[model samples]
Target: MPAADWRASRLVPRRAAVSRAQVETVAGRALGAFGLVFGAQTVPTAVDQARFMADGSGVAMMAVVYGAIAALAAATFTRVAVRAAALAFAAIYVIALLAWPFLVVDAAGMAGRTPWLYYLCTVATTAAVIALPVAPAAAYTSAVPAIYGVVRLSPSGGGASALIAVLDTMYAVILGIVVLVIITMLRQAAIAVDAAQEAALERYDAVARRHATEIERVKVDALVHDSVLTTLLSAAASRTPAERALAARMAADAVRRLDEAAVEVPGLDDRVALTVLTRRLRGGVAGFSAPFIVRVDGTDGVELPVEAIDALSSAAMQAMVNSVQHADGPIGRVRRELEVRGVGAGGCVIRVIDNGSGFDPAAVPPSRLGLRVSIEERMVNEGGSARVESVPGEGTTVTLAWPAGVEGSGE
Candidate 1:
């Protein structure tokens, strides 16, 4: 890669790393508030005590400015950025002292009393900022030094300020804790919502399955009654060679038409029982379809919400029709291995394996009407998926994963 291109690529990874670190820091800070408060407070104290602040007013003013900058950084903060900014404040405090050597502190004279009002206001502001439910950690960082003073320093006629400082420090801690609680609750709520969404998708797939089955049954019944039997009877009755030949041809055409017409269904929800589904499907096929060797595995006692059940079932029916139409090479084709297994609490997989010419799934975007209506959309709606794998002149496998999670429909 060119120099500029390589530079950009390197920067991208660095930025991503930085972003991830920030997120981790934020999560850690929330869980470890006491540690964060203690660690953050040490910075300002170290700065104030450093030789750079011996000139007093100049260093104090610089600290004030740095504190404001820290507050801004905290207000619009990311996890890593805020921590860096906090340390940056400490670094700035030091740099300001070092860059302007004239303002160096004189320890003996540096013990002058800071205004009581200054500590009170700064501490209160820090508490209020950090107390905001979503406020970042840096908001209250400036108060760390004041908090340290209340607990550490005690005095004579200059002592009332320390008492107020102690109160302020307690408020800051309480405020930070409150924010942490709020964030934790919000996070839990988000997780619940995600679970709910997954559940909804499964239910959707189940419903689709039920409806598809009902429609296919009606079509099968119609085709067998109106077309299949009528043609076969005519073929039998024909006396002449040409009459029998035409009758045989008509019978074949009717059978083909019947298979394609069988996509309609009666309405059903996602909660239909699997045993009931298999029975119903077998009945619809009657004697026209091949005998199915259904070996249900792993469904010891697992079940899913009604909607999810419906979705997977619908996808299964669609896959079956596809097998009948596309998998069979000529007649009496042996497309075996139809299995449904429950995956977990609220998940299952429907797989149909067929020995026939398998087309490139990528080259074909599911041109079959059943594929669009019953498989792809149905699986996705359930937060699951459908995969079709096949090689030319080889077999095809259709797998539909129902999803995982319980919803309002939980048993």
Candidate 2:
């Protein structure tokens, strides 16, 4: 199964799953508001503090530029544009924090009273970037504090003589790392929960399908037994060769029906084109030395799975083979026909008909692979069905139909 399809399965309850979009929305809004307010307040302090420096006007301008950009990014935050928002704000915040080295004067001391604002904005930006996968989020989260630590420890910066600046900034860096790790763990846990939910739903579906199949097998068994008994009685009382032959054919069909009941079928994933399937079916029986004609009706443009097409095509060819080898008579010629047609929405019907000395459908032997394993079982496994329709002296039709998710109907 594709990853996208697995994630999209409706089996997982909506209330039970925690979606990435949901996380992004809540986190983005919270952090966006924080960035706007905090950046607004910090800009004024940063400007005023820069005035005490010998050459601090350029530093003041840098603060205004980055602060404005961060505020704008937060104001325009969107889930779809999360990465862009995160990148824009991260750049501004990290650059602003890096300016701490320049803000630190040999004698004027730290510029902004709230130097911690630069480090805390890193935390806010981390919240906004939670939509990113673990690796990129970790990198973005780490880069912010690491850059702050590097600039703060410079000889000409905050580390000039005070150990307090290094200690204060180190505490903030450690706090940011812890927050990022916790968020990453939570994201991973949510994904695991969703996967488990989907698996449980699939198991429940399988059990239900198995129970339904068991019920269907019981019904098929009863029908096959009754048909077999009736054919046996008819054959015993027959007074002519024609009557015996018809009875024998009916017996063969009954056995085939019994065979169908005994076999287990797996579910089908539809993904093949109906037109392509018919063409393949035609090619499948090309080796037969009998006259065969393939007629397609309606649009053959419908697409289903390749397995589905194979099952239908294989069943059709088996029907044709059965007719050539069993339906032929001394006077009758084999006339095999493969017909493919579209049914309802995303549905298909394939009929393998033959004009020959047809037998009674009730008399098919249990050991006959043609109708049982080759046709009916094949169709059933593909979430489709096959039924044999025949009379004593007319013809036989093996009808196969796949109607999307509906259980196959075969007799």
Candidate 3:
């Protein structure tokens, strides 16, 4: 299957993968909203019982309870102090329940119906679940409902029978326990998902680093085969003074290449100026057996890592060498140009173009390491990229870019 089709099929599964933090935020907000709705429903009952409450006690109770609920609602959206607000509401509700008899006008007058505070029993238990840890929340859930049951049986609490009080207490306890279990299960599942995701990412990073190390090894092996072994063979075959002199030059070049490779460690922090890189390229072009028209621009004041400088320099040189060896034709008919330009912050682009004999890039065999290992793989290992554009009998353009996408700066 194509990548687009596979992604389309995975859309629903990807959307279902919610993070732990997101689950907690949504649960907190939902509980806060529920608290607001439950608080609003108790307003009518509170007003009806106002005459039974003592002189400033009713107003004080309403202010504190309503204020805590409002703060919880605000905390849901702000994602700050949510536990504090829930704890305040739970504590204040329990205090008001305990002070009900003391604040009442007549204890015997409330012998008919339930107390106004009866409606908020479940709300208090739910708030406790949100505010406290599992063990404490379970304890609070049992204790608050039992307290309400005792209050319901008292004369000031409407003189309810034993059966009604027990039923009410059991209902609140069951609901609070159910909500606690559900929220706890959701949190555990989310935490497990987060851990799995973290582990997968760590494994992927380790694999990528290993792959990069393997590519670097292959590039170094190709360099040994192309430079050192070939130079040794040439020196062994030397039969005259001129041949020996040429062999000696090749041996010196091979030693220099090996020395450079020895110091090229991965993740090196050394830096060099853009001018230094351009100067090196210019000196290399001057030393090449075939001439090249070099053009440089925007190469002032930029600095790059030593690894990047080395990769770009080596790949650009290989591109030029390929042009000299394979693209050369008769006399001055072949025109070769090398362009280097500084691009996005601490980035650069280099291009080697040759109007010599061109061949199809697709026709190149895998046995040839000049374009693959020496140029393409080398740049990729350094966090850069290389592109070769060619057509039979026309021309070839090898464009190398550092830090990727910086080639757009030329446009």
Candidate 4:
């Protein structure tokens, strides 16, 4: 495929996919807000029924139930303790239902009117759906409405007809089940998306590594054709001392080139000082179109495989280029930083950070080789890893680490 056509086909922007966590957050907040609205609607009924309750029990029930609902509503906007709020709303509503008969001043006097708790049955079940797992949520959904049904049959629960009570119970159960099914499906779909994305990334990484290997193989082949093959042809044709000496020199040059190629192969014993790697990184950063605040530390005497140095340097430079191209905004608006530091025995870590126009890492198209190929896969090919953290409009940080358990490496 033509390069532009290939990129155009694969690089088309995909609609940002929502993860499970994001789905849950939206569900929680929506349920909480709905619960609050339903709770508010119950206020007048609660006031009218307050007369039938025993001393202080009516006020206490209102306080506890309303307080829980209020907490649920408050949790809609804040991330703190959301599950706890949902649990409290569901559990408190159940407890209030169970205590209704005992709290009533005259059980029979409550006949013909629905209890305020009846308005919140669906709300409680919705909270349970948000707070618990499918099995437990289903159980809670069934049990809470059944409890309300029993309370409904009692005199304090308005002495409703069996048929009426059954209808109400079924209504709440069906609604709860509907909510449960919808939420469970959404979560399952989100999980599937996450799994698919992870698998695609793994496949892309493997393909990228294979591509790098093929390029190296081609380089070796080219070296053989240009150097070794030519030297052999020249040596075979030599008929004089001067010509033979020239052929011998050509053979020696080819041997040196072959030796260098072997050293360049990954996993070789050829080592370079950490300082050499850092120096290269510094030079690259200095040459960038925009200045980067560079910091280097603890790279004095450490040594690493030559392949590792090359991979790290290339990945780090690619990360910087990505920042400059994508993250850098107007002049003097963005602050870019590059840090190269040695860690453990001889491993190194590089970080490129920019306070500029950030982006969603998850939204990046697979065809963007600056990240998946030039940075991430390059590090993985060298037995290292890269992490990119960014939020749209917040900032971006790309961290590259070599030799995976570098923290605990012994001298």
Instruction: Please give each candidate's TM-score.
Output: 0.34, 0.48, 0.61, 0.68
- lDDT by residue (tens digit), candidate 4, 165-230: 999999999999999999999989967865665455445445545665686799999999999999
Better of 1 and 3 by lDDT: 3
**Arranged by TM-score, best first:** 4, 3, 2, 1
Which 10 residues in a row give candidate 3 its minimum summed lDDT?
5-14
Question: What does candidate 1 score in Cα RMSD to the true structure?
Answer: 20.2
Question: Which one is best on TM-score?
Answer: 4
Better of 1 and 2 by lDDT: 2
Best by lDDT: 4
lDDT of each: 0.50, 0.59, 0.77, 0.79
lDDT of 2 by residue, 1-411 (tens): 122321111121112234333344455555666656665666666665565444864476555555655654544352234456666666656666665555455423552243544535554446535546667666766666556555555543344334655565566556666767766666566456545543543454345446556866778767756887888888899889999899989889888877765553323543545666655555554444445666665534577665676666667766765655555333223466776776544667777787665667677789876678988888887788777888755777888887533324221
Residue 215's lDDT within candidate 1 is 66
The lDDT, on a scale of 0 to 1, for candidate 2 is 0.59
Kindly give the number of clashing pairs for every candidate: 27, 17, 0, 0
Clash pairs, model 4 backbone: none
